[model samples]
Target: MSTARQNPLSYDEAVTWIQQFSKSSIPRDQVTASFSRSSGPGGQNVNKVNSKVSLRLQLDRATWIPPHALQKLKTSPLVNKAGELQTTSDRTRSQGKNLQDCYDKLIQAIKQAVTVNRPADLEALAKIEKR
Candidate 1:
């Protein structure tokens, strides 16, 4: 059981924890990121600077995540028509931050789908043991 905690875990921290538990490694090459100009205001200036970040990942190419987690990811809402997982971030003006935000979103989604409820999981396993 987790001990006392004060602050909530950040997305990157959660991803790290999940990675440790799953013994998985996320490959950077598998992630493709694109930057486009942020919309609204600044007309030509907006078109010139690419502040929005878009990220794409292929589920078929994912290998490090646990099988159960992969299965969950396949059915997740993050999957697109092309069977690719996609995410974006444009709220921030900084291109770098936007890119990181996109990555964080992807990680958080995968973590949520993969992470099981410990109490419920233990209960289910206990029932199996009785049989």
Candidate 2:
């Protein structure tokens, strides 16, 4: 179901892809980023530079996402209360790593939205649950 090929994009590649997708599928004003202090390791530098990146996408303002895509995005765990898709990666002290991680997360989110299956009806559930 994914429009993306099976090549398995790297973090940088994924981010570029997401940016392009956003241009076509989401309003420019709907996307934003915030910097925060990263948790978990990284020593003293972590306390100084806010390496964590939070990518937010305001779904309600998006004109590009189809209705079905919007529904899937809403149900996805990636979305927050503000209807923003957030992703953070600070495993490494490097900002590049964190940025790449965020991109990968976004790519995964889109893939999820594109491929999600509808819930089965009660009759279908009954048949499966009976096993």
Model 2 stretches with alpha carbons more than 4 Å out: 1-28, 116-131
- Expressed as tens digits, the lDDT of each residue in 1-131 for candidate 2 is 34453324454554454456732454547767677888858889889988887777787775455445667788888888877777777877777777767776776677555543345779999999999
Residues 9-65, candidate 1, lDDT per residue (tens digit)? 445554566867521356877878888888844556666789888898888887655
**Alpha-carbon RMSD of each model:** 10.1, 9.8
Tell me how many clashing residue pairs each candidate has: 0, 0
In candidate 1, the residue pairs with backbone N, CA or C atoms under 3 Å apart (3 or more residues apart, or in different chains) clash, namely none
Extract clashing residue pairs from model 2: none
